[model samples]
Target: MFFDKSHLVALGGNMPSAKGESVETLRAALDRIASSGCELLAVSRFYRTPCFPPGAGPDYVNAAARIACDAAPEAVLNLLHRVEAEFGRERVKRWGQRTLDLDLIGAGDAVLPDAATYQAWHDLAPDAQQSEAPDRLILPHPRMHERAFVLVPLADVAPEWRHPVLGRTVVEMRDALPDDALSEVVAL
Candidate 1:
C-alpha cells in the first residue's frame, strides 16, 4: 500500500473557544476540516506542547492531520482560516495564545510562489522572525524543520511525507531535533 500525505494540517490552541477548551477546540477543528469536502486520512495523538518563548501562556494542544483535497493551496488556506474563525480564533497577535490554529502545512510537495520566496522566510533570523510575518503563505512551512511541536505530531501521521525543498521525510526532521526540543512535545 502507498500512503501520500502531501496535504497536511497542523492544529494548535491554548485557549477556550465556542467549542470549548484547547483539546476540544482542536478536535472540533479536525471535524470542521473533514467537513470541507476533504478526506481526513489520519490524525496524530493530541500533544501537550509548552508555549513558545517559555511561559507565554498555557501549554497548547497540538496535532497533525493528513488530508486529501483537490482545492488550490490558497483556497485551502482560506478554508483553514475560516475554520479557525468559527472556533473563535482572533488574529490579534503574531504568535499569541489562540482559541484555534489551523495551518495548511503543505499540499502535494508543491512549492508556492517559488523556492526563492520560500527560502527567504525559511532563513529568517529568530529575532527577525518574531516581528515579521510573511505577507503570503510559505509552504512546507518555513519553520517546520525546527519545530518539534509541528514535526512530532506530523511524524505520527506522515512520517514518510517528504519536504519538497529539503528532501527530508517528516520523521527525519522530527528525529534530528535535540532531545530537549523533542522533550517539549509530550503526548497527551
Candidate 2:
C-alpha cells in the first residue's frame, strides 16, 4: 500500500487451458491481489466471448473489477504482471492468446503523460498496432466502448460506468454498437 486511490481493473483472456490455467481459475489470481493488500470493491460477472485478434482457439471469458488500493500505479501494475506469470501467461504473440490479462483501467482520473511512459511504468510492451499515447488511464478503455467483449461484462457490473473521455455509459456504448464483432455474453 502506497497511496489511497480507487481504480478499475479489467480482466480477460482464455487462461491457457493447455497449460492448465482455465477461465474458472480466478480465485488464485484474486488471492494474489488480496495478498498485495488491495481491497476488492466490486467484480463483474464473467462473460464468454469469441476471441479477438481472431484465430482457431477457444473463446475467452472476460470480466471487469473495481478495486481500492494504496499502491502506486506502477506497483499495482507490477503485481498484476506477477499474477499473470503465476497463472502461466506466455508472451508468444501479439494478443495471440493469454492465460490472464489484467489491465489498470482507471486510476482516479490520472494520466500517464505519453504512451511510452504508460507502457514502461506498467511494464507493458506496445502492440505494434497501436500508434499513439493516451492522455488518461484511458478508462472505460480507449477502445472498450467499441468492443463488445469489454462492454457486455462491463455493463454487467458497471452499466452506468461512465467513460471519462467520451462521457458515455457502458450500456450506452453497448446499445450503440454497430457491428457484430462482439458476440453476446455466455453465462458461466
Candidate 3:
C-alpha cells in the first residue's frame, strides 16, 4: 500500500524477553510492526553499544527501521509502545535497561507540539533530561542527533532524512559528533 509519509523507529534491547534472545525479540517486533499497518521499507544492521549510564547493564543491540504509514504520529507511537509491551518492556526507571525499546523518531516533516517546545526539550540539561519526560510527543526526536546508537543505524536506513527543526540530514548529524562518540556502536 502507498503511504503518505515515511517514518523512522529506533529499536534497542539489552535484556532477553519472554521471546528469548535480544536479537530474536527485535526481529519479532519488526514483524509485529509490519503486521500492524506500517510498511517495512528498510532495516539497518544491528549494532552493539554499551548501556547509556556506562555500566547500567549489558550492552544493547540497536538498529533503525524506515516505515511508510498513513497513521497519525500519535497512533504510530501507540503502536510502537504496544509492541514494546509485547516484548516485556517496563518503564521502571528512566533510561533503564530493557528487553525492548521502540522509539518513534520522526514522521515525514511533521513536528509535534511546536518548534519551541521541541527545542526546549532538545536542549534540556543532562540532569534535567534524566529526571524528566515530556508530556507529549516530540517530532524528529529532539536528541536524535546527539546519540551514536541512534545515528549509526539510522544512517544505514535513512541517511538523507533531515530533521525538520534542525535542518540537518542524518549523515550530517552523525558526522558532527566527536570521533570517539560512535566508537562503541560496532555492527553485529
Candidate 1 clashes: the total is: 0
| TM-score of each candidate structure, all chains considered together | 0.95, 0.76, 0.96
Q: Quick one: ranking by lDDT, best first?
A: 3, 1, 2
Give a tens-digit lDDT track for model 2, residues 19-40.
3555555555766787888987
Over 4 Å off, model 3:
1-4
lDDT of 3: 0.91
Residue-pair clashes per candidate, as listed? 0, 2, 0
Task: Report clash pairs, candidate 2.
Answer: 2-70, 3-70
Kindly give the stretch of ten consecutive residues in candidate 3 with the minimal lDDT sum: 1-10
- Model 3 clash pairs are none
Per-residue lDDT over 30-57 for candidate 1, one digit per residue giving the tens place of the 0 to 100 score: 8888888878889999999999768789
Q: All candidates' lDDT scores?
A: 0.88, 0.66, 0.91
Q: List the residue pairs that clash in candidate 1.
A: none
